[model samples]
Target: MVGQWSGREARALREAKRMSIREFAAHLGVHERLVSKWEAGGDRVHPRPVNQAALDTCLARSDDIERTRFAALAAPEPDSGPRPDAGRSAAPGGYSNDAELLALIDTGAARGEGLAAISEKDLIMAAAHEASEHAGRAEGTNIGPSTLDQLDADITRIANDYVHTPPMPMMVEMLRVRRRVYRLLEGHQRPSDTSHLYLLAGSLSGLLANASTDLGYLDAAGEQIRASWAYAEISGHNGLRAWARGMHALIEYWSERPHRALQLAQNGLQYADSATAAVRLHNIEARIWSKIGSTADTERAIHAAADASSAAAADSLHDEVGGVFGFSDAKASYYAGATYIHLGLAEPALAATERTIELYRTGPARQRSYGAESLARVDSAAAHLINGSLDGAEAALLPVLALDEDKRIAQLEERLTGVRRRICAPAFRGVAEARALDERIEEFCGSTATRSLPPGSG
Candidate 1:
C-alpha cells in the first residue's frame, strides 16, 4: 500500500511500471544522469518542463499500479491475469498526484526551506515568462480599463511585498514586468484613454521611485517622482497628484532643500480638498513647515493632519481615487510623533514614538523590523537630549552615525546634528569622544547638504 509517495516512492512507482531509468530518460528526451539524480535524491527536482513531464508519466504508471493492487484485493482467484480495471485511476481526483506535488512544494516554502530546494524561483520565472508572452500576443491592441486596474493592483502588491523583504535576484526581472505593463499603456493612443493610462503610469512611477529610494539611488527617485507627478496631473487624479507632489516634497526635504520642500508641500495642498487625501497632504505640509522653522504653520498643519486622520478613522466619505492611500490610527500616531519631535516637544514625541513602536511590534514582524530599529535609536537620542543627558544622547546616536549616508534619512541626520550642537558646550568638557562624534556628524551633513537638489525645480 503506497500511503504517500516521497521522491523515493515516485522512483519506485516508475520502476514498478517496468520503466528503466534510462528508458524513462530517453522517453522524456533527457540524459540518463538526470533521471538517476532525480531517483537517488542527489538533487531535489523542481517541477520544470522535463521534471513535470516525468512526473506525469510516473503518475500514470502509479495509477496502473494502484488499479492492479485494488483488483488483486477484489479477486477470489489468485492466478487471475492482469485485471481490466487495473490502472483505471491510480490517484483519486488527481489530488494525490499534481495537487499533492504542489502542496508539498508549498509546505516546504511555509517551513522556511530555501527556494533552491523547491525551485520556487523557476516557478516565478516561468509565470513571468507566460505573462510576457500573453502581453506580446495582445500587443498593438487596447486592453480595457479594468484590465489595467487589475495590473496596477498586482504590480503594487509585488512592489509593497518586496520592499521589506531581502532584495531578490529576480528584482530586475520583476521590474521588467512593470516596464512591460507601462509600455502597454503607452501604446494606447486614444485621448479618452488618457486617464487610465496616466493612472497606471503614476502607479508604476511610484513603485520605481520607491525601489530607487531603497537602493540609495536618490537621483533616480527624484526623476521617477517627477514622472509620477506629471502622470497624476494628466489623469485629473488630483488626490494622486497631491500624493505625488508630497513624494516630491519628501525628496526635497531629504536632499536638504527646505525651501523647495515647503513649496512642493504647499502645491500638494492645492489638491488636498478631497476628504480622503487630506490627511496625507497635511502630513506633508507639517513636515515641510518643520524644515522651514515655521512654528505657526507647522502647528496648524499638525492640527489639520490630526483632524483629517480622525476623519479617516471615522470611515468618512473617500474620493474616487483608485489606489491605496492614507493611514490607520497607529500610522497616524507615528507621523504625529515625528511632527512633535520636529516641534521640539520632546516628551510628547517620545510618548508617541513609544505608542507607534508598540503598535507596529504587535502587528507584523516585517513592519516591526523596517524602521523600528532606527526609530528606537532616534527616540532615545531625542529623549536624552531633552533631559540634558548628553552622554546618553551620544551613546544612543553613535551607532547610527556609522551607517551609510542615506539621503532618504536626512531627517534622522538632522536630528542627530541638533543633539550634537545642543551638547557641544559643557557636556563635552573637551572630551575627544564628543569632539569626534560632532566632527563626524558635521562631515556627513556637509556632504549631504552639498548634494541637495537645486531650488525652483519643484
Candidate 2:
C-alpha cells in the first residue's frame, strides 16, 4: 500500500470506494466500455479526472492523491537546446549578443576614445558573438525586464556614438543590428518585450533620418522619418514620434513649404505634451510661424516653449533630457531670436541672440563657435543698420561674408541679403560699402536678385 501503484493497484483503488465500472463511468461522464478498457489494463490507463476523483474518494484519508494528480497532469519539460556554460554560448538558433558589444562602444565613446581601431565588419562580428552568448544564458531562464532594459540602453548608446563619429559606418552597423534584433525578438512572447524592440527601431530610424539630412539627402531623410514615425506609433512612444514630426517640419520649413511646415508643427505639438518634447515642438512651431511672417503666432509659440522649458527644468532633478531629441535653453533662445528677426523686432532679436551666444559659450566648443560667430555677425549688422551706421554694418558683415558659405546657418545667409538691400538709404550716401556688401552676398548666395522676404509687411 505504501509503494507506487501499478495498473492493478490503480484499478483496485478505483473500485474500493464502492464505485462499480458503470457507476464510475457515469461519474466520469464516459461509456462503461471505455472505463473497463482503462481498469482492465488492456492498455495502461493514464489517470483521467474520473479515475483521479475515484482514487481520491477511496484514499480520502491518504496524503498522496494531490502528488499523484499533479504528476499525471504535469507537462513535459521543454528542451533548453543549449546551456550558458557549454562550449557553445549561443542558442540552437544562432542568436547574437549585440547589446553587450554596443555597451563597450558606448563606454569608449563616453571616455572620448575611438572604437579601439576596430573595423565595422569586426565590430559587428563581436556584437553577434555577444548576442549569441546572451541568448544562451536566456534559454532556460526567463528573460527579465531589467535585462531587456539594459539591452535597449546599450543599443541607444552605441547608435548615438556611431552617429556622432562616423555616420556612414553607423548606418551600416544599424542595418545589421536591426536585422539581428528583429530575429531575436521574433521569439519573444510578451507585449512589453516587443515594445522595447519597437523603441529601438524608432531610434535607429530617427538617427538614419538625421544622417541623411546632414548629407543633404532630403528624399532619404523623409523616408527615414516616415519609418521612424511608424515605429514610434507601434511603440506607443508619444514624445519620440512628436520629435520626429518636428524634424520633418524643419525639413519642410527649409524647403520653403511654410504652410505645410505649420501643419506639421501643429501635429507635432499635439503629441508633444510632455515637458521636453513640448518645448521642442513649440520651438518648431515658432519657426514655422516666423517663416509665414505670422508675428502673433510666433510670439505665442515662443512664450509657450519658454514656459514648457521652465516647467521641464523644475521637474527634472538632473539637467539631462532623454531620447535623441536635442533641445536646450540655448536652442530655444536661438529660435526665439530667429523668430524676432523675421518679425523685424530687432532689439528683442539682438537680446535673444546675445543670450544664445552666452549659453553656447559655456557649452560644446563646436556649437559655441557656430552660434557665437553667426550671432555676432547678425547682431553687429542689425545694430549698425538700426543706428544708421551703414559703413559699420558693412564692416561687420564683411567678416561674416568672408567665411565659407555654411548651409547649416542658412538663416544667416538670408539675413545678410536683407541687410544689403535695406541698407541703401541716402543718409548712408556712401553707397560703395553697401553696394560691396550686396555684391558679396549675391556672390555667396549665387543669385543676382535678393531672396524674397517672408510674406506680408516685409
Candidate 3:
C-alpha cells in the first residue's frame, strides 16, 4: 500500500476521514501543495519514501480497529459520564484555536453526530466572548441593520459577478465584510438587530466558503462552511439554512461524494417551500443520481426540480445569491447535459446542450453567466465529438475558446481538458480535423494555466 497508492486512494482516505488537503498535510507535517499534487496526479505520481512512510502510517491509524470501530458497538453499552474536561470548541465563533477545533471535529466524527448536536446555552456566549476578544482587530466602523442589509446586497453582487471578477479581489472584499460583521456581533445591540447580524455573518461565510473552494483550498472551504452552518443555526433563517445545506451538498459532490450529496440535498428540501433553493437542491440530487447511473432516481430528481422551478416562478421567489444558490435556464440545461453524459445517453446530452446554447444566445447579455455558458459549450462540443461530428464540435466550442482569460474558471478548464482527452482517442488521433482541434485545445489550455492565479488564493 505504500508505493502503490494512487490519487483515488489518497483522495478517498482523506475524504473518508472528512479531512481536507490542508488538514491532512498538517497531519503528515508536509506542505499542503504537495498533498494536492499527489491527489491531482492520480495513479501517475508516487510519493518519496518519507511521505510513503507517513501515508502508510496515516492509513494504518485511519483504520486502527479501536479508532474506527462500528458505531453499533456502543449500542448496548452503558452511558459513560462526561470526561474531566470537554473538548475545545470547533465552532468558528467559539473556538480559540484551529488545532483544538479540528481535533474536536475529528473526535466528534468518531462518535455519532459529534459536536454538531451540542446546543448548550453557553456556546453562543462563548462565541460572543471570542468575538469580543478579537474586536480589537476589527476596523472602527459603526454598523446597524442598514449596514447588514447592504452587506446582503454586496454578497449578492459578488455571487453574481463571481464568474467574471478576479477571485483575489472578490475574496478580499468578502473577508473584509465578514470581519466587520463579526465585530458588530461583539458589540451590544437589540435582539432583533443581533439576529440580522447573524444572518449577514452566515451568508458571508457561505460566500467565502464558495470562493475558497474555487481557489482549491478545501480545508479553508470546510472551515467557512462550518461557520456558515453555525451562523445559520443561530439566526434561525429558513432560507439561509436551505442555502447552506445546498452549498454543503454541492461541495461534497465536487469532492466525489455523490451519495452523500444526494442525502444533503434531500435534507435541504425540508426548509425549501416554493423557494428557488428547492430547485437548486433538486438539481444537485439529479446530478448525483446521474453520476450513480440511476435512471429512475435521476428522472425523479429532474421532475422534482422542474416542479420546484415552476412553483418558485409562480411565487416570485428568485434566489438573491446568484452563484450557487440559483439555477438559470442555461444552468439547468447544462446540468441535464452533464447527467445525460454520465448516463451514456449521447443524444440526450447533445439535445440538452443545444438548449443551453440557445438560452445563452437569446438571453440578455447581462444575464449570461460566462461560467455556465462555457461549461455548456464544452458539453456540446464533447457530445459532437462523441457522435463523430468533428466540424460541429469545433463550431460549438469556438465561442467558448474565444472567451477572455478573466472569464474562464477552474470548472471550465476541467471540462475543456476532458474534451481534449475524448478527442485524442485512437480513432481520431491521426485525423486532420482531430489534429487541428487538439492544437487549438493545447494553446487554449496553456494560456489558461499561465493566467491562472496561484492555488489557495482565497
Q: What local lDDT score does residue 266 receive in model 1, on the 0 to 100 scale? A: 79
Clashing pairs in 2: 96-131, 96-132, 97-130, 97-131, 97-132
Candidate 2 Cα deviation (angstroms), residue 53: 54
Note the clash tally of each candidate.
2, 5, 0
TM-score of 1: 0.54
341: Cα error in model 1, Å: 3.3
What TM-score would each prediction reach against the true structure? 0.54, 0.53, 0.64
Global lDDT for candidate 2? Answer: 0.60
What local lDDT score does residue 439 receive in model 1, on the 0 to 100 scale? 82
RMSD of 2: 22.2
Candidate 3 pairs with clashing backbones:
none
* lDDT (tens digit, per residue) of candidate 1 on 420-457: 66667675668787677678767766644224435642
Off by over 4 Å in 3: 1-142, 312-324, 447-451, 454-458
**Preferred candidate (lDDT higher): 1 or 3:** 3
Please report, in order, the local distance difference test score of every candidate based on alpha carbons: 0.58, 0.60, 0.71
lDDT (Cα, tens digit) per residue for candidate 3, span 184-256: 8876566677787888888788888877776556667778887888988898877777778887887887788
Better of 1 and 2 by TM-score: 1
Candidate 2 lDDT, tens digit per residue, 269-362? 7776567778888888987897788888887988888788756332110122232355666767777777776676767766787687677668
